[model samples]
Target: MMTDGLDGVVAASTILSDVDGAAGRLVIRGRSLDELAGRTSVEEATALLFDGFFDDRPSGGEWRAHLGQARHAVFAEVAALDERLIRHGPLEAVRALVARLADGEDLATALRLVAAPAVFLPSYLRLRAGHAPVAPDASLGHAADVMRMLRGQPASSVEAAALETYLVTVCDHGLNASTFAARVVASTQAGLTSAVLAGLGALKGPLHGGAPGPVLTMLNDIGEAGDARAWLEAALARGERLMGFGHRIYRVRDPRADALKRALATLGVEAGRLAQAEQVEAAALAVLKDHKPGRRLETNVEFYTAVLLDALGFPADSLTCVFAMGRSVGWLAHAREQATSGRLIRPQSRYVGPAS
Candidate 1:
């Protein structure tokens, strides 16, 4: 028997992370999402995730220093960012710059691949907006430095911590599509940069990393909490799929969504906006249940992701790039894991075409 989208297929065994979709839980390197999201820094989480995967991986304290160095190293490629590349936008522009990186499976290579988006994203965004790119401050933490570079000023401790929560929460999650794509490339011995590029290509798809922007659009269209039900009902009547309300794997509320909602609450975003979003979420869940009685649909990460990142002042267009920055660590770690122990990911497909 064959399955569409290879549903329920077990591709590779990993010691990295596990996604228990049935329970709506995510565990990374033996720690639950809740334990890490609000407490761990991105550098610390990366250190945890990278342990045993790389020879001579940095300790938690050393991880920050190494990541800062990686950011500085990746900044050299920013000179390649010209008008033509800027026109392609942040994601494509960062992709192009990342392509320039030398392919390798070593610790240095991993750091650079992880750092590429942090350095390249802000540089591209700034250059596109007619501002000079800011240099990396190796003394600062990874999330803080990215915010600092993006705004040409330091991010408040609260802002930095909120971004850290997002980064840690999404750092890795089982064999997600992009992580699987990274693993497949790694299995081919294509090196870390190539694997990450593969993952980025996969994530560029709308069905995956592209939904957060649309969530913001939905919120904008609805305008107010009182208007949410009518707006959602009309959209559903027209057969429109509600953005950020469903997931392929999870049958319950996404834990990451709750994590981000908490983070958004701390950001002190416009009281009305957050309240309206909460009302909209409640309204969306109730409406979705009424419309699709047999299906499980609840708010997923993208819903709160839109609100939180928007509150952080990142434009919706650049949201996916921001996601890439958080997820790149997972890609590198998965690529390294595959290269270390896994084989080429060649799956057999049943013939469905008309017989010759």
Candidate 2:
């Protein structure tokens, strides 16, 4: 019964959060993600996360804007390095960029820490495929800068709003796997960037946050609407866990899904793709309802994440890094929270495999 590290010993109540997995609800500081996502900017979410952890949040748009500027400025430092840098994978190039920013201290350091992957990772992906990364203009909003960099073009207000919603929605969660990993690194007093690197590494695992982009691939390969059932059946029959249908923590439909689905709909999702996606959701839900009825294996956040990001033109390969954009805020907030608590997080582990 000891899973992973046997570290799950009923952790004491955390003012941090409460996730009702069976209900698929999350309460961050007593506010629901749905209520928060629609009206919040990524900046606002960051403030809420650090509300208790920090007395001074970069107040208003200042902290968010500052982080945006810092990410742009630091990433630009390496934009010229793209030619040779592209030879390295996006993740590696990203790690190097963080290393370069290791010198800055104050707010600049925190900004660079939060924004490193957001700026560098997308740029790295572009440079690898012979595309140029766009330079960031501080005047632009955070979501706009992200979309502009990812697409190499300016973004409309709708695009910016939708992307910001995503970044905010996923910005923080009660200590999930990746956030906990980040806190573990942060507990050592490692730099914020170091904590994030740990999170990204954990997220890269297929079982964690890596499956959303693939969900789109599954949808595409299913192609015609008629093939969804048979194709999904074959995939399931072969023991493949259908990518977007279930969740490790949520039981009912994921609350994040509704938030994202609402955002995607507001963005007026792309024509046939959205419709196809709707159809796919319908078919998949029908199947899961019949096959795993008691399990509550409904569409999770990843289901809508694929649809939303694809609508925004993110390549599947970039999804993990894209996810990092939103989730990084949560990582930093949690790291700061844990650090402020002064607990070193030394959990006990039971060894089972043959302790030499």
Candidate 3:
């Protein structure tokens, strides 16, 4: 028997991360999610992911310099992309532009793919907002340079650390939709660029990485603390799904949700909005319990993800692009893993209709 969405189907073996849906646990490279998110930087997580894979892997001071150089190397490409491509949104433009980088399965290609968004996103967003793009500072850390490029100034320690938490928290999960897409592309012997482009395309879907934007929209609509329950009730009455409250996998609270909430609390910006979200979360959880008694619809990562990104001054629409920045590391990691299998990812499909 086949599952409709390939549910519960074990595709391939991986040493990267594991998603224990029953326990609501995410373990990356043998470390718990909580231990990695707030404490580890994205650069550190990248090193963890590429530990046994890449031959030219840099560690300690060398890794930071290598990554910083890669970011600086991509500046011209970000600036040279056509202005018209922004019509498809920065994320789509990012997908198209990544294809312009050299194709390979080597460490250099992996580093460049990882660095593309850190350079491309801020540059693209600034240019789209009618400002001149800022160049990357090769001396700064990954999250710090992203913020620097965005604001044309150094980020506060709090802001930079929050962004680092966000990036590391999302650096890799289980074989999520986008990662799976990347792996499938890689299985076909396609280059890293093609695999990453496939991942970006998959991530663009609303069911996947697009919900964070609407979580903010929902918060905006509710407006006040006392209004959350009533607003949520009316929404549920209209059969509208709450944006951040449910997940397809986790039967308990999403582990990343707490990690991100903690990250936002660390930043301590936009206290009023954060309080409002907390109230909204409590109200939504209570209401959902009363409404869908049998279902486990708890807060997921995107709930606090929205709050933190908003606190950092990112527009809601750009949340997905920001997500891509962190997740790009995971995509490339999975792509490289799949490419090593030496077996194409060809699964048999059963025809349900007339066999002509």
Candidate 4:
């Protein structure tokens, strides 16, 4: 028998992070996702993932300094991509520019690969929007600097914290589609940049990193609390798959969804709209329950991800690009881990055709 999508298959062992779908828990480096959300900076969480994993891993203040230096190092590469910016969205443009970086599984190469998006994504977005790119602040933390570059102004405490929470929450998960792609490329002795390119390619697909923007679109379509039930019912009647309602894993509520919802609540913007989102969520949940009683279709991260990022003033198109900024660290860590395995990730396929 074959597992069609490799569901429930254990392909590799990683010390990076674990996804306990049955329990609705995510743990990174043995720390629970809830504990790290608002309490830790993205740099700190990156360091946690890197500790004891990389040979030349820098920790504490030094890690932040190293990442800062890496951001500055990629500045020229980001600028060079300006002419080609019109050809791709921010995510694709950043992927192409990052592929041009030096290749290797070494510590310096990994740091630069991880920093590429943090440095390049905002530049790509700003340039595409007909604005001059803002330079990265070598002194500020990763999340704050991303916001700074995007808006060309310093982020307030709340804005910085919200982005940091998002970055930290999404940093890594167990053998996700993109992470698996990165590992496969790394297993072939490819450089970190090549592996990361593979990961980004996978993430570009709708099944993985594509749903967040649509949740906002769905909310915009609903418009009012009173219309939410009827709107959802009409959509369901037409056999439309509701966005942000279900997950492949997570029998219970998605912990990441809950985490992001709390982050949006903390930011305290668009009170009326937030209430509308709540109403829509409840209506959608009820509809899903009545329509499909056997399946547990609860809200996933994309719901409030839409709310929080929209509230932060990001255009819907750039949402996935921002996701790449956070997930880059996880990809690098997984790439480095796969490099140490020394075995190519080759799985045999069963032949079904008749023998000649």
Candidate 5:
């Protein structure tokens, strides 16, 4: 009679995390996600996520150096891939690049595999747009190299720092749906590369991290601040969700949204878009609070994820690619951890269909 299984079973014994969706709490490697977002570097966060689990964690500078090396190593491999079928799309190209990393069996090789998409997708965008994608450099920081490969120039110090902050902040949360999927694959004793591919496929879904781009489209459809509330109401009546409004977790405002909003401002975002997002946020918050006074629904990470990526000179389409850069760290840690546990993650399913 285990119809709906009870929640929060002790799935594993790890010092990694606990996400209290009800209390709006997300603790990572011992600190709250709010406490870590934008306050730490990707390398720092990776070290934290892998702490106690791995004996050797690189410093921020060292990790950057290693990823740069990975970038070059992967680029040579991508050259050998079927260029005709490269697909010229972020998810497809990135998936191919991620899958290619399995050729190397070591952890460092595995990291490079995971890091390739962060470097490759941007390059693919440029190539698709008829611009030559620049290669990565080992001397720069992680964010700076990623920007350089995509844009043919290095990111400004402020922009680079902001991007790095984002990568670190999102590197890992608890067992979110995507991370959980990765663990499930890894639990099969599938290699880490196989596990990461599972994560990317899961994240490609709109319900997961893929909604940020459409949030921008939603804002565009409203056209102006004056159109927001009316458009939102109509959309709601039609059973449409205002992108970036509700969250699966977090009853209050998502702590990640504000941190990214701060970064957007620091990066000198366009005023018009920022103003529109602000209006939509204000109108949505007021309406939601009044409509469901006791409910926990609030602005989630997608809200500012839309605004921030938009401000970075990326078209609305680049949201998932950028998100992949940040999320890959979390995927890598979870995949490796699950593989180390040496247990399959099979859950019993309820049989409600026509019983025989």
Candidate 6:
């Protein structure tokens, strides 16, 4: 039997990460989400994901240096940026720049693909805002440097820690749509850049990485905590799906949502906004329960992702690009794994049309 959208299909085996939807748990390597997220730097998490994937895999410290160097290397491509690319959104602009990288399966190539978003995004954002782009500081950690480049100033300890938590939380989670896309391309022995580009293409879909921005839009529409229930009820009555309340896999609350909420708490978001968000979350949960009593609908990552990234001063439009910065490492790791150990991914499709 053919499964639509390949639901319940086992596409490839991986040692990378697992998403236990029933348990609301995410495990990367051997570590749980809580164990790795706020406790590890982006470099350390990247090292964990990269372990055993490459013959020349760098240690955590070495990965930090290589990631910094990769960022500097990717920064060189910023000179090629122009109004044409910047006219598109940040994700597209970054994807265009990443397309310029030479395709390869080597560790250096993987590192550059991983670093591309962190380098290209701030450059694209700054250029779009009519400011000069900031150069990468190879001495700083990956998450800290990304924040510094985006703001053209150093991020505080709390701000950098928040970003690191966000990055690590999203770094990898089983064979997600984007990770699967990356793996499919890699199974073709397409280089890491091509695999990552495939992942970016998949992630650009609204059903995937694009939901966080709309969550912000929903929050803005609700305006105040007191207004959340009525506005959400009306929207649901009109057949509008709430942006952040449900997940495809997770029957319980998403663990990443809590991870991001904890990260948001550290940023000292304004009292009114946080209170409004908390109230809206409670309201959304209640409304979802009343509207769809049989279905289990709960807060997912996008809800707090919108709140946290907004608190960090990132533009709503660039949130997906920020997501890419973390997930790129996972994509590269998945790509390397597929290229090294897996066969080509060629699935047969049943014909539904009339016979020729």
Clashes of each: 0, 0, 0, 0, 0, 0
lDDT of 2 by residue, 1-356 (tens): 55674344453346656778877888877788777887887667766766766554576758667766776677665655555666765555666676666632234565666677778766776777678777776667778888888778888889889898888888766667788898888778776777777888887777777888789889888885468888877777787888887876776888888888888887764767777878888888887777776777888888889889989888786777778888877777777766667477787667669767
Q: Which stretches of candidate 1 lie over 4 Å from their true place?
A: 224-226
Where in model 3 is the C-alpha error above 4 Å?
224-226
lDDT of 5 by residue, 1-356 (tens): 34353354656665577767677677887898778877776656766666544555566557667766777777765563346635556787778767766642255756675567767777777777777767778777677777777778777888777777677666776777778887888788777677778888888889987899888888888875457778877777787777898876666677777877878778664667777788888887876676668876688888888887777766676677778778777777777777776489877877769978
Q: 1-356 in candidate 1: lDDT tens per residue?
A: 67889889888999999888889999999999999989999888888888888777766678889999999999999999999999887789999999999999889999998899989999988898899999999989999999999999999999999988998888998888999999999999989999999989988888889889999999999995448999999999999999989998899989999999888888875566789889999999999999999999988988999889988888888888889999999998888888888889998888889999
TM-score of each: 0.98, 0.90, 0.97, 0.96, 0.91, 0.98
lDDT of 3 by residue, 80-150 (tens): 65667877777877877787898899888888889998888888788888888898998999999999999
Residue-level lDDT of model 4, residues 1-356, one tens digit each, is 56878898888988889999889999998899999998999889888877765778775778788888888888878767756664767677888888889888777888788788888878877887789988877888888888899899998889989988998989998899999999999999888899989988988877888888888889998894458888998998998889988888888899998888788887776666678888889999999999999999998888888888888878887788778888888988888888886479997778889999
Each prediction's RMSD to truth: 1.2, 2.5, 1.3, 1.6, 2.4, 1.2
The better candidate by lDDT, 2 or 5, is 2
Show where candidate 6 strays beyond 4 Å. Answer: 224-226
The local distance difference test score of model 4 is 0.85
Q: What C-alpha lDDT values do all the predictions have? A: 0.90, 0.75, 0.88, 0.85, 0.73, 0.90
Model 6 RMSD, rounded to 1 decimal: 1.2
Residue-level error in angstroms, candidate 5, position 185? 1.1
Worst window of 10 by summed lDDT in candidate 6: 266-275
Find the number of clashing residue pairs for candidate 3. Answer: 0
In Å, residue 204's CA in model 3 sits off its true spot by 0.6
Model 4: residues with Cα > 4 Å off, grouped in runs: 224-226, 353-355
